[model samples]
Target: MSIYSPLPPEMIWEGWEDFKPVWQEIKVNGRILQVEMQGFNQARVVRLLSTDPADYLNSAYQPGCILSFSPQQSTTPGAINDNPPV
Candidate 1:
């Protein structure tokens, strides 16, 4: 099996073409990609990739925030490059 089997706990949320939801909340509690999003006002989502969750809580969030993952990105599955050059 692959090193990182299975995927993280996906969070279902929608953004305005850009992923600028509530806030990115991630933790390295387990060696798995886990993302959780809350609904304050409007839809929000989180996509986990690396073993470490991408936390954005209390961080900068606003318009023009490019979403690295989305329908446009669905074409290329497993296309995220979080690893270093070998």
Candidate 2:
């Protein structure tokens, strides 16, 4: 019997798209915040990757803001990164 099972949490972002809702990293007032958005929907402000959630909440949200995502070598099945990279 093989003992190499991995369970990862499911990440859900409202209004998800194949490649449109791209992940982004923004610099707000010298702090960095990771975000992902789809259409005109409210952008998802990633918390775990940021220094503080409060900073993101207080910072002005501009959908036109441009950012980049870090590359992940491997991603868990059914996770957000499961889909082909954007």
Candidate 3:
């Protein structure tokens, strides 16, 4: 019986509450992407393995906003590929 003391008196206390992610990681254009938060809106893409394909850039990113990537290493879900460079 202590979930913030059942605040229900014209509630008014905004502080502490900045941590929610079913999956996050974004740095678009520079490399590093792994979004997966489809609850408050949308944020697909949970795969992207670049060995040197120009780092695979061109992902402005949309839906809400609040990225901070730092984890990359994927490739095995359909195996996207389109080789065409010497």
Q: Superposing all C-alpha atoms, what RMSD in Å does each candidate have to the true structure?
A: 17.1, 15.8, 12.3
Clashes of each: 2, 0, 0
Instruction: Report, for every candidate in turn, its global Cα lDDT versus the true structure.
Output: 0.36, 0.50, 0.53
Summing lDDT over every window of 10 consecutive residues in candidate 1, give the lowest-scoring window. Answer: 58-67
How would you order the candidates by TM-score, starting with the best? Answer: 2, 3, 1
Per-residue lDDT tens digits for candidate 3, residues 1-86, read 34565676345344336545576665467656677865454557665545666554435433333444344544554333565334
Question: Candidate 2: where is the Cα deviation over 4 Å?
Answer: 1-21, 38-42, 48-86
lDDT of 2 at 3: 40
Q: Please state the error at residue 57 of candidate 2 in Å.
A: 11
Q: Which residue pairs collide, candidate 3?
A: none
Better of 1 and 2 by lDDT: 2
Highest lDDT: which candidate? 3
Model 1: residues >4 Å from true position, as ranges? 1-19, 32-36, 39-45, 51-86
How much is the lDDT of residue 72 in candidate 2? 49
lDDT of 2 at 33: 57
